[model samples]
Target: MMLYYIYDGTFEGLLTAIYDAYYERENPELIVAMDNFTDNFLIQRRYIDTDEKKATKVHNGIINKISEDALTNIMYAYLSEHENAGKYILEYLRFGFKVGRLVDSYLSDDRVHNIHKLARKVSRERHLLLGIIRFRLLSNNIYYAPIDTQYNTACLLGDHFAARMADQIFVIHDVKRNYGVFYDKSKWFISDIDTKGNLDLHEKELFYQELWKKYFESTTIKDRLNPKLQSHFMPKRYWKYLVEMK
Candidate 1:
């Protein structure tokens, strides 16, 4: 019987779950953010929460067993949040287990190639959001931005904005994920914020939104419009946060 391990959707939590699974004699399948069994065939499943110590241990172990690049690739794949991330990780780990120390050379393998490709895509999206995200100044001197992302990228983008906008109070909402980053001009924190309640635009903010929408519509060339190309560059999922579209 294959065992199942569930984690709390953090990289550290996943590592701790991996540490738990490693002690077992039988290899098991690991999953995150799932509570139900697919087949109802009496599968043994265990849930693990984030543990910094256990995660550090597992991370250190992986570094000792494989190269740093392997660990980075695995972390990138984990961040992708793609449907097949767990299976992709399993394939990567299997390759690592067989090759022991030379698995990095398997970058050409289809499984490894896909993981790297997903990582690059997610990275690019996060980078674009960092430079392109616009914040509206609220009445209380707080800047706010709302976003909907296909990946869990709020934490990553938070670091970038916090450093650049260090002198101002700001919050960035990942509307799709129901979480956001709040920076009070000194420190930053992440929390679950309901966009419906917090994002009621004030008159000034509304005016800016209107002006941005007009600018966006005005900038488009009728003869040069390519819906497919535009969609590929700026996916529909993120349009909710784009000031130009709003």
Candidate 2:
């Protein structure tokens, strides 16, 4: 008999699914987001809701039994949004319960390897965005930047930028996800946004944009052009929001 577990697509929902898997004593052959579920007469389907208590239980279990790095990797892997991410995370936890923290060291295991690999990709993208994100000063004096990443990475960038620009207000909008982190000098929080709304820019914003473009033009050596190397560091997809690229 094939059992499928469908979840609400949130991390907590995924955790709740893991909790039910253990207490219910049923191993799911397929774990997927609820929206992705389809009708199948051969498979028994279960929809798991996001339960904070159950999610916390699983979270505490991971932190205590496994390592903090393991929990972090699980989060990163979930954020990867891979098609089988839910199933992979459930399998990883199932193995982690047996060997405890040593589960991470089992790189030979396919499930463990996949979790770590997904985490590495997410981490690399987060690091790359730190240097690539460009901010534009708005008329309200708030520094606003728009990002459209393929992965869910905007949430990971808040702490890094907040610490660097502690005294300034800024907004990092993930256009692809329709949510952003808004920091007002003292605190920051994530919220949904409408990217199509009017953005009142500072009077000198255009001047600064031209200046940046001119600087980039003057600094580039036409004879020493390295399109391959430049593209390697800064992917072309991110060029849309860059002032210099404009």
Off by over 4 Å in 2: 36-43
Candidate 1 wrong stretches, greater than 4 Å: 35-39, 48-51, 64-68, 97-102, 194-203
- Candidate 2 local Cα displacement, residue 189, angstroms: 0.7
- Model 2, span 165-204: residue lDDT tens: 9999999999887899999999889999987778999999
For each candidate, the alpha-carbon lDDT, in order, equals 0.75, 0.90
User: What are the RMSDs of all candidates, in order?
Assistant: 3.1, 1.8
TM-score of each: 0.81, 0.93
On residues 78-151, what C-alpha lDDT tens digit does candidate 1 reach at each position? 87887567656766765676677777677799867877887787788788788667798777767888777777
lDDT at 35, model 1: 28
Model 1 has an lDDT value of 0.75
